[model samples]
Target: MTFLETLLDPFQYQFFIKGLVAALLAGGLCGLIGVFITLRGMSYIGHGLSHAIFGGYAAAPLLGIPIVLGAGLWGLASALAINAVTRRHRIGADAAIGVVTTASFALGVALLTKFGNKGPAFDSLLFGSINGVSIGDLLLLGGVFLGTIAIFTVLYRQLLFSTFDPEVAKVSGVNVGLMDTILMVVLSMSILATLSIIGVTLVAATLVIPPVVARMLTDSFGRMLWIATALGTAAGAVGMYLSYQLEIPSGTTIVLVNAAVFLVVLLLKGAKGLGRTAGLDDHTDASATGLVTASAPTRA
Candidate 1:
């Protein structure tokens, strides 16, 4: 077969089409949210929340609940719990994340051990199954993507202010707490929606890698958002095609693609320069146009 014929072979399968669209939506969504996550130093939240939501994934079927609603609610509650724990206690955000997510993941493992795997295939949930993605999954992904864009549009300034300087944002009457909650809720939605395609094990890579690469490429927050989104969307589509060609796990392949991009960006930017750019540094332009120059405050 010629190169074009070989590449076009997968299009004959409906599952491939669904999976590809799901991946594209997931990648772009993660990229958009990842900017906030990395900027606020909440990178671990993506990792932690994905694990925490696994408990819900394991439980929803047993309890006769819809996977989307059940697991999504569980993820949201866990996120809120982490936020509350951090605020009300002396424990740091990292510590709270470790505690909450580990316990939740443990619950998942325990349930699986006691009751056996139910709902979906055991391996597919952990490692992802592109062929398993259904029409419903695609709809959920699209909905979450649009919802995230709407939220970001309506609260752009508020989120930006709270992200860089929560204290100042609060003093300026930005309702920093509400902004935090909004972000957590949207993040929960994003993770829950993308869980099926990226799987629990590899989702965090999609969230972190794209934004980090974007940061290395640009100093402007607005540009970072666009660059990250574009990279993620491209990674998703390209990774899907590559996974089909290579006969590998889709989620793993997608993550490897992101990692490869990260490496290339690191090499191009140079180690010293990447270090300088990737680290949270003060920008010179702190304007309403989404160019933030202030050093972001540590979130707990």
Candidate 2:
């Protein structure tokens, strides 16, 4: 077969097309939301929420609820509970995530052991496969992707303020708590939408890798967002094609592609790039001022 024929072969299958679209949507969505996630130092939240939602996935059938609805609600509740615990108890967010998510995941395991894989397919949910994606899953992923774009566009200033300097944002009447809650909600929704395509185990890698690579490439937050989104979109499309050609798990292929990109960027940029990106947390407020634009309070 010619090169073009090779590229076009996968298009013959409707399933491949659906899976590609789903992968593209899920990857880009994770990239967009992941900026705020990493900036706020809550990188673990994606992993945590994914595990927590698994509990709901297991319990939904027993409760006679649809898996999507039950798992979504459970993920949202877990996000809120983590937020509440961190704020009210004066403990570390890491500790709160560990305690809550592990317990929820343990519940999922117990349920699976006792009841069986009564929710979705066990291997698919854990490792991911494009063959299992349905029309409903595509619609859900597309809807969530569009919703995320709208949220980020509308709340740009507030999100930037709260992410970099929550105390300052609150003092400037930006409603830091509300912003955090909004992020948590979006995050839960993102994880729930992506679980099937990316799998619970690898979802966090999709969320973290693109943004981290973008951060290494740029100091400006605006540029990072654009770069990360582009990288993530490309990774998804390319990874999906590669997975089909190689006959590997789609989720594993996507994550491996991301990791490969990260290594390539690291090698090209060297230690200086890594060190500079590492220090962003310290200078994020001052360095990222240009991101929030004129709408941001001058006081901030």
Candidate 3:
């Protein structure tokens, strides 16, 4: 069936509709923040936050709290802890990520013993069942996505500058540290928003893969972000289809589909670049560097 026909011939399945909505919101948010994640070469942080979200997820059942809210706080705390440790102790981002995320997640798992009889549902945080998604989840996703876009509108130039060249950004009067911290919070929040739809485990793929794909196609950072957002949305929708037909987890299916697309686009674009640079062995040394370059964005 055509795309229009498939969507129009709805089975009146409210759950299916919910799943689609969830994917769209989650995918869009991940794609947007992913622009920064990719530019900064900090894909590992996204991976760490995705898993660290389990801290909040584990807290919900025991403390009689909402998992998303708990996870958001968990993510924020994890980000701060990582930043502090890395700053004060001369630890790196990767090492800090391992220490904070694993520790927080382990604590969450350990605290489960106190809430006897009210066993925490495993899938609530790990493997999201689309049917369990409520209207509140949709609202939270919408709020985060819109808020992120608004913030980006105001700070895009600064973020782009800092991501491309922290030293220049600092010298040029941009608040690189403050911008970095705020972006970290936004990223942690984005990961939390997507955790319900993509699950804590699969969020890294949704965030990193889309931007990675976009980077191959565009030389300009702003254009790359928009392209990444589009790719993410497409992957999200296709993932929903994969989940429905395969009788599998929607979030996992979505993430896997995204990964496949990323691989395909990367190879395709890389080949195209090589083909163009084939004969220019000495003359077009610039083009041989391919599309990726370190020309920093200018701050406003």
Each model's C-alpha lDDT? Answer: 0.85, 0.87, 0.74
Candidate 1 — which residues are off by over 4 angstroms? 281-300
Q: Where is the poorest 10-residue window by lDDT in model 3?
A: 280-289
Candidate 1 has its poorest 10 consecutive residues by lDDT at 281-290
Q: What ranges in model 2 sit over 4 Å off? A: 1-4, 283-285, 290-295, 298-300
RMSD of 1: 3.6
Model 2 Cα lDDT, one tens digit per residue, 1-300: 999999899999999999999889888888888888887788898999999999989989888999999999999999999999999997899999999998999999899999888778987888678898899999888888888889989888888877877777778888888888998999999999888888889999998999999988888888889988888888888888888999987889999999999999999999976875674456454568655544576553
Worst 10 residues of 2 by lDDT: 278-287
What are the RMSDs of all candidates, in order?
Answer: 3.6, 1.8, 5.1
The per-residue C-alpha lDDT of model 1 at residue 260 equals 96
> Which model, 2 or 3, shows the larger TM-score?
2
What lDDT tens digits, residue by residue, belong to model 1 across residues 118-231?
Answer: 877777778777878998999999999999999998898889888887777777677888899999999999999888888889999999989889888876788888999999
Number of the top-ranking candidate, with TM-score as the measure: 2
Candidate 3 lDDT over 76-195, as tens digits, reads 989888877876797888999998898887776677645432433566467655665678878988998999999988886777666665676788778888887889899998887777
What TM-score fits each model? 0.93, 0.95, 0.85
